[model samples]
Target chain A: MIQKKICMLGGFAVGKTSLVRRFVSNVFSDQYQTTIGVTVEKKCVTVASQEIMMVLWDLYGEDEFQHVRDLYLRGSSGYIVVMDGTRKDTLQTALALQQTAANTVGPVPFVSIINKADMRSEWEIDEHVIEQLRDRSWTVLFGSAKLGQGVDELFLNLATQMVQRPPLSNTHP
Target chain B: MSSDSGRSLPNSPTSEGFTSREEDWTQLRTLLLAPEQTQLDELRERLDHRMVHSQEVSQVLPEAIAIRGVGDQQLSNALTPYVENGFIAAVRKSPRAIVDAIAPIMGPAIRQAIARALQSMTQSLNRSLDESLSIRGLRWRLEAWRTGRPFAEVVLVHTLRYRVEQVFLIHRETGLLLHHVATDAAVVQDQHVISGMLTAIQDYVRDSFGASPDQTLDQVEVGEWTVWIEQGSQAYLACVIRGTPPASLREDVHDALAHIHALHANALADFAGDATPFKATQPYLESCLLAHYERPPKQGALKGWILIGLIVLGVVWWGWMAYQAQSRWSHLLDRLREEPGIVITQARSMWGDYHIEGLRDPLAKAPTALVIEAGLNPATVKMEWAPFYALDAPLVLARAQSILRPPESVQFHIEGGILVATGSASPDWAREAKRLAVLVPGISQYRDDGLVTASISALLDRINRTVIHFPSGSSTVEPSERVALDTVAAILRELDQLVSQSSQRVHLEVLGWTDATGPPARNLQLSQERAEAVVAVLREKRLDKAATVVLGSVRPLDQGGSNQESANQRVATLRATLTAQGQDSQTADP
Candidate 1:
């Protein structure tokens, strides 16, 4: 049994916490509950027929007042950068946190989950912006934590990346 | 020469104005004077932010509050609400996680409280047993028998019955407590830990035996206390019980779990550490704590009243029977009085039996036999009798006459079975006669003897003699002779049998005589004349034709008075015999 430490990073109200809650308990809430610091939860999933225990650290949302702490990003095996599909500026914030994680530790496996896909009619991130990130060989998933659509697939894709990638190449921040 | 002593002066362009130490200081000054300096600029920028971002401050706030309030009452009071809010928020995030951290302290507290409760219950049960066979226990036993329950179960209930201490509803998959409730005396300090422990035990059982996921731990006995669990589809119910509970309590647990699933299945499926929605199932879970009792009967029951009634009826029946026997005896006596020749002089009763004592005729019926015939106990009837011949009036009269030898003048007879007598007799004879008559057979009663005194017929019947004598030679009646003649006339006047109705059939005979001293012819003539004079006086006294005066020859006696009275010879003795006509009256007096 391999326990992989993972983190969820995104801007404020970008469905990072909702995404973890949906993947762990298969539940969604319309009411937004603000998280402080970090809350750690655990769930067991199988990737490539190997049982992996995913220890998820749900960090506080990054806004103008509170940004992601680099200490919380230490010792993480992989991470999922979440962005709200209704806002284009939240995608910029996810990209900045991705670069910070690469510099602070080293580049590990990661995914970008464009969350709130249930509100596709209100999506603000253009298709051209998504095509540019895809050309960089970065994996991306569009999903909704509220509707529980593609939420579990998004977590499983990240778990698969941690399993196939080269091991112990970066420093444990 | 000064340069040789200290080769300090540098051969730079402005060496005279700026030495090496002086040049280093001038460059630091130059750097300080620049518009944008890297190190100093960064220090000012870091200090400018005044802790407006609370990430670093928030990390130390809780620890600061705890250290400040360590020995200060006011500070602790001020921070109490915030601490409670923080704890609640932590619990809402992960209930199972919080319970796992604090289980060591909470577990001992719950176990000790339940131990105290069970100890007190056992002590009270022992006290009641020492107090004697309690009415409460006995009544419960009877009720248990009626309701088809076991005796030991009923006894336990009346003595120290089990109570439902606490109830909890838990999520089966996550082992998080959904809802919880407890009695006032319950000691469930932490409900989340108990729920987690119960789920852990269930999982242990299932995994150890490779059982199905639906398998659950139904009952767990910890000393005198028991924990009952019931598994549902999404969640399960657990109950903590103290003392002995009946076997039927499992049904209550099952019902509560079913209702919780029915009401909140959708909420639990989406439970993201928010247990508020499951609070609606609190009442349903609490209702699973089941307790039942039976009331004891009041006073004595219907069987006691029935026994008393039977005793009263028995006494009344015996009394009625005794009264009936006495009445039967009285009726028998009345019937005996009506029978002929059955003379009952005395009859009495004692103690519901009869005592009959009196005269009874030889021909009368036996009283004992009649009592037996009347369907009574003969031993209860006592009879005594004095025998007699008869008690009729005529028979009693004849018996009295034969027994008493009264004088001829006295008479005896009977009236209404009473003896009566009449006439006169001596006093001595009358008393002796009455005494003897009373004892005579068939003489039931004795009356008075009528005997008269001084009777003339009684005197005359005894006397039968008469006398007549004449003086010498007198033809007329002498003075003494006149009374003698008068008596002769009276005797002829009375006495009907002496003066016969059939021509002087009654008779009185008389003779005449004279003395010797005269010539025969003259003496004879004088005697004849005297006799004629007696006859002539009788004739003057009106003698009937049947009365007779006889004249006969004279007779003489020896001479004594000399020849002086030769007329003595002429005195005639005349005797008259009055007899019936034409009849010889030889011996008429008897």
Candidate 2:
């Protein structure tokens, strides 16, 4: 079994862990539990009829307090950069962390999940940002782990990308 | 030197001329001869003064001759080197005079050197404190160790800790806080205010004393907060930190500034106070969140001991709980052994679960129920015993009572395999007792003939009105009405289940009514269909199996000019009544 490493990078409380748990366990909780321990989870996904085991690293949220360690992204196949749909500032943090991860591990495949899609009333991320990301050939999705919506498709597509994309060069700063 | 003499001759011949040709010759000759005679006398007197004064008077004479515009450049040039040489000779003879002359300037310089030496001594002495966890502190300790400076400095360096609370990327020229990321908030005051103040202060420092352009405020410590400022040509990154941060954070600030400059050089260089492009440096700014720390080596040792202590305590507590459980179980075993004609086959307790099996005498009361009195739940203690033929009616009743465990509201007696239960019970308890009675060994029949339900007449007489309502003419249940219908269905199920266990069988009569708005036949049909719809919903919920759904026809529920009354009339109602036995009602309640 080929085990691929992936990272869930985002700002604080943006449902990165929630989305991963929902994908791995098919369960979601309403509690806003910040992920402080248990960095990664392993789940086997069958992509293209081949079982690919995914090791997902739920990196520390990039907020005013803590930043994701670049050591956590070494030799990874890909990552999912998450942003809270309700906070517009977190988008900048997500984009910046994405750039750093690219610099650290070279550019692997990545997608953006604008989480809390169920909270349409409190949404703050503009559609133009999503459109801009889409224009850059980036896969953008809207999801709500609470409602068990779009969480599986996002991870499954990433799994497929991990299998299909060519391996990146080993040398990364 | 020559021009004046030539001009004097012209003046003598033209302006002050001689009068007669022979007399003019005599006057000119006398004038020229007289000026020569005056020069001859002055030279003779100066020669006598030079002879008396020696070379000193001659050197003074050149100086006097070198007075402004009195003599030409050549004459002044001759005296310049002479005066300069004389001054040098005098300074060489007594240099102390020059030194004393600049006493005011040298006074501060000498004192400053002494002060600097003293400050260095004090810094080395004071930095020998037992605690200071800064990069400077690290170097201090290293210096103390490598050079054998002091032990206290080593200790001091081991104690300091610092964290970068926030980093702000500000335009150097405009001082706009373009982007900021912090562990805490960036600034208590407005970021713009702080940035503007920083610019004002920087500008003031630059302009105030005409200090060197290279001079810039490097570190600003305000109480526990330290702002390490790293200025670039285009921008600066000010790290708001606490404690003394490491040198790496400064390097990080420098690297981040350089990276920002490289990326947005044009934007920062020509920044119009627009923060949009500067936001591109947000990622690099977050690198300032890195913190440097140094804790005492004893902390790890202390933590180890605490962990060991906790583990020891946990083991003790666990062993104590196990000991208590064992003693209690052994006491229980002792009591069981003391019982008459009882043989203990197997009895032990492990992991808080007790298992006991023995041959119990029929006459001795089973102590299984007594296990609960010992602060233990009897259900957790598994007890099994073989039956013996020492049976009696009272024993049979006891067995049935133990198995059924009827509520205090209920009472019952057993005769042979037939059990008669009576008293008052809520519909659920009554149903539970009825079901539980059959499970008692040797009991074939069960009865609750004497049980009187609590105010059953009140329940039957009252009609559950407006429990469910249909939209104006629709037969479908609205989403909001399902909650009320769910409650209604629960009550019906309990009623049906209770009646099934009782001697009297009861079922709900679900009726739907419609207001008189159409022809009587149509209203009747509409009302009938609505009732059927309500019945179908109830059946779908599986609330009751016994329900006699009837169409309670069109009643004029409202006067002309009111929609509320009409809506109220378009509703479902339920009435509970004793169902006929063996009627095989089409609506069977569960």
Candidate 3:
């Protein structure tokens, strides 16, 4: 059995907390309460016939709280950069946070999540955009926090990937 | 003595031997009449003399004498007859045996009687005169004092009737008055008399003096009298007549004194040194000198300063207002220049819509053509064009005419992908030209031939090549990919007219694809996420979102080889489909 820590990061009010709540608790809350500092949740699953425990660190979604992001990512096996699917500006903030995590915690597996998929009518994300980002080594996922759809599978698959290629320094004791 | 004369004298014991009874009666009558007549005659003589000598004294003397004679008229009149008689007759007639008999005894008695009468008369006359004169002088002096001329060298004296008193003398160098008292008489021994006379003299001098150097005098009081002596440039003399001497006699004394003093002053004027008593008092006289010689003029400089201040203030205020107006106008001009195209478009659209009803029938004669045939008349359709910037006049006029009527004739031309439609419709050719313009995309430059057509599909294909992609829900560029996205937004904006003509809403499909490295569920999610990211970038460019749709696929088996696999698997495809609301099918596809 192996354990992995993962971090969620994005701009304030960009669905970072909602996505984390959807992935960890398997439930969605319409009312958005801003994350205060870091909320850690654990979920166990079977990947490649091995039991894996994921310590998901949902961080406060404000650029001002970036000082504390490295601390949360200290033992993270992977990271998920979450952003509002309809906001083009928030996507930049998401990528910035991802870059920060990468530089501070060394190279780690990470995926970009475009949440709030139920708003597809107003969804502005397209294929050429995903291909363009793919060149940067970021995997993309879409989910709707309000409908509790595609929420669990996004994290479950990330845990499996982490188990297959775990970080060389798993310092968490 | 005659019995009648003896009987005339009283039978008193003291008078019985003093003189015979007849002598006593005659002497008594003579004594009474003579003394009275003599005193009265003296007063009359003084009064007459004063009248001839000084008009001022004469004016008041008659009234004074008349009042003094109130009690002694009979005695005073009887003196007339006796004076008319010979003095020799009285001496020869045994009137106490002439000088030896009457000289010693009668002399003392006559002297005493005369003294008493004169003293009483003077006291009575002067008391009344002094009171009236003092009150009148005080009133006049107070008036002068209020006018800032509280002091002077000479004053008109009521006591001397109309004559003026000289009370001040000037020091040589300073030209100031040195002494302030009358100068004609000697200094009085009695303080009370001197003080009263001094006060009257001062009041008179201060009221009459004109503050001129020529009228300056030195005055002093002497025993119930005032004396004024000319000094400096002055040659006039003044005297105050007092005592119970006849008014005529007093006038004579005053005349004599004034004449003598005038002579003396004139004679000594040249001999008097700068340090003479008169010259030492010039400082005191300076203040009373005419104001013209002492004060300087200041009005010219004061007026110039005020005028300069007013001019400066006026200029400052005018400049401030002009600057404010210029700034306000500049702001308005900036707003107008920033959105010129939008303002022009809105105006043209409104004008076209306003006359739409009249241009519905193509067979009807064009309103503009009819108006032109009727001698260049303007069309009835009202048009208003408000351009944010100054617009070309020919363009606006042509546009207005085309809106009013469509042409019937047709011509054709083609350049690049632009289709120029020009023709006259019965109503107007504007609607057909506008329709053709809307259909042509990338018509950057064009010339109208009146009829032409071009393929719009080729334009959309060109636009597609410029379209770029982003990571799903991310603003981060995948290095070297931003150029494509920028081009796409620019081309879309450029071809906005063609796009708008097909349908206001263009349904955009963003197909997100994922590499084979992820599981089915995750891959599907990733694909959808990628599709959303592309859509977001489009919306940021102000693309119509209601016209947008996203489709994603997770074909893990479709992965390519090596570096190409990541690029091919993660690629997103954009497709725009034009559709109208409530329509089951779309017309245009790209």
RMSD of each: 27.4, 43.3, 63.0
Predicted candidate 1 versus true structure: per-residue lDDT over A55-108, tens digit per residue:
677777998877675655655678999999999999889989998877665778
User: What TM-score, to 2 decimals, does candidate 3 have?
Assistant: 0.23
Top candidate (DockQ): 1
The digit string of per-residue lDDT tens for model 3 on B1-590 reads 34455564666466557467557567776775777668877778877796555766678878876774543333444555676576768766866667786689779868966875686577546544433344344665675577655322112222223222223432222121223333222232432223222323333353345334344335555653445443323322233333222334334434443443454464334321111343333323222211011111247546755887898889998788656544433443334334223221221112112221211122222334433343321443342333232233333333333443323233333445343446322212344555545333334333454433323354346544443444433434464765666565544543443445456554455666665665668767777776666667667777563344445343444645565555555656666555568342443333
Candidate 3 local lDDT, A1-173, one digit each (tens): 34455777788887877777666676767787976656656566776665665656676785653443354455456788887878777777877788788876667677777887899777666668778888887888887888877777778778767655523543222
Descending-lDDT candidate ranking: 2, 1, 3
lDDT of 2 by residue, B443-514 (tens): 778988898665444444433543567776677778898777676665554455446555555556666677
DockQ of 1: 0.01
User: Which candidate tops TM-score?
Assistant: 1
lDDT score of residue B517 within candidate 1 = 50
Residue range with the least summed lDDT across 10 consecutive positions in model 3 chain B: B287-296
* After superposition, candidate 3 runs with Cα above 4 Å error: A1-173, B1-477, B494-496, B499-503, B515-518, B544-570, B582-584, B587-590
What candidate 2 gets wrong by more than 4 Å, as runs, is B1-590
Candidate 1 chain B weakest lDDT stretch, 10 residues = B454-463
Clashes of 2: 12
